[model samples]
Target: MTDAPAPKHYAPRWNSDPRPDPPAVGGERETLSAVLDWHRATFELKCAGLPPDRLSEKAVPPSALSLHGLARHLAGVERWWFRIQFADEDVPMLYYSDEDPDQDFDRLDGDVDEAFAVWRAECDRSRQITTAAASLDETGVRKRTGEPISLRRIMVDMIAEYARHNGHADLLRERIDGSIGV
Candidate 1:
């Protein structure tokens, strides 16, 4: 008989969304990027096995936030900060416009699989950009202000943003079912 595919191993009930903790070794770039990657994986893990309908579900009511929306929102944020602001790449907004500023969350009109693809691409690009940077002190101008923003500041801000939003993801995932942790 042909070799059988390996069986999937699901996390035990006691395992609350565990992920690889941030690296204990490496320089600033390595450590910061590792932690960011961990947070990114945590978000994906929180969304693991969720159906599209549930991902799009605004189960909380009165709040437009959904995992699908958060994915799109984070994609836009990644492009905004890393590509537009730091890399100085000229591009249009991936989602949202003056007339539809909150479209990322307010309206779920497209294929969520596509949205996740876009988010994943953006996240990968952001990591690549961070990796290629000469140093954390390298500066880029703020989009709204001509004032400069250091790569270090951007990293810290992004970490904080993800941390806060992951908390939201936690509650959202739990509401969808009862998954928690990381």
Candidate 2:
């Protein structure tokens, strides 16, 4: 008698995303923006299909890095780097203060949906600022140090920021559930 074939196994999928793949070849601005946007989408994908408790679960012991916290922190970062620093907009800070600096990650207050909405708005504003700039060489002053920072540098730095946090997100997502992927 022929032996029974091994059963097929399929990985669980928690969410479906229509995020476009970044172009392998493109202009500097286009390439940077696309990659950044892709990272943003990846961040959201990691947090999708989870309840609020799961979203805010500090799955890893001794580290308070939840998907919810990441969402809040990233929203602040997008505002701080893009609007406040790069565009020099006179906007109020999102979730920060001198007395309570790590509020974004530490204090996971407010609606998750609201946090995401704010993040999206900040990203849209950042895109507008980037598009309006004459070149990546466009400069903005550093708040702490009286030095100029270029738009190109900001984009590269933001990409790195997202990359590091995305790594954290991967771990957080995996810990939250068996699901995993880019």
Candidate 3:
């Protein structure tokens, strides 16, 4: 008798349960936080439970856009906006060194856990900074560019940036396997 092929093992989808609708907030500050939360959650959902090879897969030639890279890039994004811009701290950028600025997405020689750990650390830092701020009206200066900006704008920009990257992640994940959705 011929042996049957084993069924493929698909990674479990991240947080498939739908979130309860956000409660009404008193003002724009609360609303902005809620939006940011949603974006963050969505991004996390895309990367959850992916294996190392899958996370670091270079499906597209000449492009280093892997799940690990995305996570690393997002960590850099948080460090730039929250740590440098908002906290007024002088922190060196991660994943981007002498080699290439695009190294954030470039596949490096590390286990999947390392990349995810870095990503989670940055995400937690971002949440702490955002949560501590009194309001979106808080003003801050960009460290590198020396441009005047406000927390409100940063919050909005973060959401937009994350949303765009999340779209890319969705397609990448789908290509890796067949799983989809939050």
TM-score of each: 0.88, 0.89, 0.82
What is the clash count of model 3? 0
lDDT of each: 0.86, 0.87, 0.79
lDDT of 1 by residue, 130-156 (tens): 989999998888979889999888888
Candidate achieving the largest lDDT: 2
Candidate 3 colliding pairs:
none
lDDT, candidate 3, equals 0.79
Which residue segments of model 1 deviate by more than 4 Å? 1-18
For candidate 3, the C-alpha RMSD (Å) to the true structure equals 9.9
Candidate 2 local lDDT, 19-69, one digit each (tens):
888999999999999999988888888887888889888998899899888
Tens digits of per-residue lDDT, candidate 3, 1-182, equal 87999779865545554444445765787787777777777777776777788888866566668888888888889888888888887889888876788887765677677877887898789888878887777878986678878888998899898989888888888888865874
Write the number of the candidate with greater TM-score, choosing between 2 and 3.
2
Could you tell me the lDDT of residue 62 within candidate 2?
92
